[model samples]
Target: MATPRSRGPELEHDVGRTPSLGYEPAGSYGSVRYLEHGFPNPLVRWHYHEEYELHLIVATRGKVFVGDYIGQFEPGHLVLTGPRLPHNWISTDVPEPGVALRDMVLQFGDAPLRQAAALIPELAEALPLLERARHGVEFFGLSEAARERFGRVRAAHGLQRLAEFATLLDLLVRCNDYRLLSTVQLQSFDDDAALAHISGIVDYLIEHYSESFSMAELAQRSGMTESSFSRNFRRATGNSYTDFVNHLRINKACQLLMETDRYITNVCYDVGFNNVANFNRRFLQIKGMTPKEFRRQAEARFGSAA
Candidate 1:
């Protein structure tokens, strides 16, 4: 990991790791669309991007994760995150009757945006917003005007997009009410070798559910001693090595239960659980439902065919 402090101007990470990924640096405007979807899953898997990101949640309530900080989210959230900061959005309150989940995301690569800050001292002042946005950059005094200014981003034109993004960033800088998610600069998740090791560990657990794996083995794969690897992995993702791998397993198990034609026993085995009984227990602990029950509810919510 190229050292990442929790709070500072040095926050930047690679974009290849993100799930809801999209970029348009090759275009004339070099602007990109930031979007979030309701399908596949309600959670945006924890990941980081290389681009400077400014997210404005257009609707609903949720929690934002930047590094280690978490906060109740509401509409009109205007956040600016520095490059490579790890973050994600999780909806806490689904929408009301007849309403769909309201979400939005915007991404911008550093290429076209190369000298955007150098050209504007105002943008430079907003660098703190990037640091603050790691743990979600909670907004207290900026919401009203930010909410008003953010609507301009949908202008559907190049110059308009730039102007709206500029407006959004400016609003965040002058706002007095906000806090950072992590205390250190967050560009730590950018190392390709480290990420490769992390990704391998994640993929390994996902493929082998019922088997037992140890942190030592994971560290060996990453070419680090157990303790050093543990510390760095946690620092990189705000998740302990074992806990993150467990979460990954649990997540995969839930997905299988929710969307598959396989039986519960089969699903458990398919997800790497040798102990079906234990699998049930852990699934309930994390998902609040047994495999059969989860499948039933998932059918009702998204359609059995889903």
Candidate 2:
């Protein structure tokens, strides 16, 4: 994957706070808000908010960062991230004019759903799915349907919009072919400064995973002591510095293995591992399969030629 260019000037100015894009139409849609934006827009960045986001990639293919999990995404890639889980998608391939509609997003709060579930037992069925989304849930084979449902919700108002939103949730709740992207569920932090600090570090790691760096260097950069950095990092991301880096590298390796016919050894080195043996060991530990096995399985599952 090619390195993503700078995120432009808007992101540099507002990296941590959520963009106030006139969320949730008044007197109608209630808690759920529908939003769609193209690439190179100000809304695209490494940030978090107190809303569960159902995000669908309608255009472009590139790296997606959700917490410490880094992976490739193409058109139809659909994921739901729970409240306050930092995430971003950087498209590596874009035409000069850029994509007109790169993302379809539905943002909703958890409390409203929980309260509704309390009064309406049937609505409680979605609780498990919402809990799973806290770690970032990627639903497979639901992109087309999700896009249509999002449109219906977007076009409707008041009760009609709420019903359409619930319909989309119902489909997601039934999907079994899904994976939790992040290994650990991030704990909420009371300190906004600390949250922003950890989020900035995560963005740096995702963008520069191939480059070499150490916890000491990161601590120095953050102006925190080495031990303090480690503790806060673990608290915010739910992974030790080493483990988080490994997860990021392994995820990138999986993307390459599935998309390219590169040699396993080369793929290993390309994803920042130094040796084949160590790479194989770590791959097995994380993926429960060898890189060769992973490639073969991916081809078999996707019906793609090796």
Candidate 3:
């Protein structure tokens, strides 16, 4: 395995043929495939699936977008995405066009998983792992043993499958080198429109965060009435339109403050907040400190390192 590097630059990958929302590949997955990869734009745009997915990104440094939280991903990073959660692993830096970014995708035969999960035993402990997978859990505890085991995931398959799966889950259930993406609402694949609509709104905010916008514009993006879009958006993301936009601005502000040497008021206007007082209040509210304090803390942590 390659030594993990620091995060840098914009992500880029091929946007290829997407998996169907209803896609469930046939096979006795429990005693089945240990590793497989053939998705055209595998690391590209967001797509949902019914089968449980265990993605082991070896060597390829990327960003795993489970829901709203986005951050650094490195080698030996294991993510178990529950059925139907829209996900995409964007390369933090562009890779060779023809030589695709490498990742081991372990897709479970949901049939066996559901069946095995129902039987009561010490295995019941694994249910918590499955339940947490609902919000797309990411492993942060990458040990040399478990890390090396993941490096083989793209090569293993058949008879030895169940045993290895148990091992993987054991590592996941026991490891502290991970953070639950968050305790988020679980809608699953049952609601497709809401899922697509929420992402559409996120894209809009990303594109126009600095510009003034209206609820009606967001509605137009989702092709729904303002009230309808607002309700669905809030329901899907656990944040209202106005509040969500504010959160995005504050998050961006926090990043700029932490990462750059920009002025406080300049950072404010840069992330969409106009009023200095409003920016200070929102930044303090979300970050538990004023902009100056936040910068001071960041400097305190990184200054000595530099």
TM-score of 2: 0.58
Query: Per-residue alpha-carbon lDDT of model 2 for 59-153, expressed as tens digits?
Result: 99877767546578999999999887767788778899988789889988899999999999999999989888888999999988999998898
Q: What is the lDDT of residue 239 in candidate 3?
A: 76
TM-score of each: 0.48, 0.58, 0.49
lDDT string for model 1 (1-306, tens) is 123222221222433324443322334343755455452253355556676666766666655655433345677776666667666665545544522335545566654543666786666675555555544565666656665654566444587778787777676677787655543222346577776666666566556755777889778977888987887777665678665655556666655554456667776776666788987887787656677766564443322222
lDDT of 1: 0.58
- Candidate lDDT scores, in order, read 0.58, 0.79, 0.63
Report per-prediction Cα RMSD to one decimal. Answer: 11.8, 11.8, 12.6
lDDT of 2 at 280: 94
TM-score order, best first, reads 2, 3, 1
Model 1, residue 199: C-alpha shift (Å): 5.0
**How accurate locally is residue 245 in candidate 3, as Cα lDDT from 0 to 100?**
79
Better of 1 and 2 by TM-score: 2
Which runs in model 2 stand beyond 4 Å of their true positions? 1-28, 184-284, 287-306
* Of candidates 3 and 2, the better by lDDT: 2
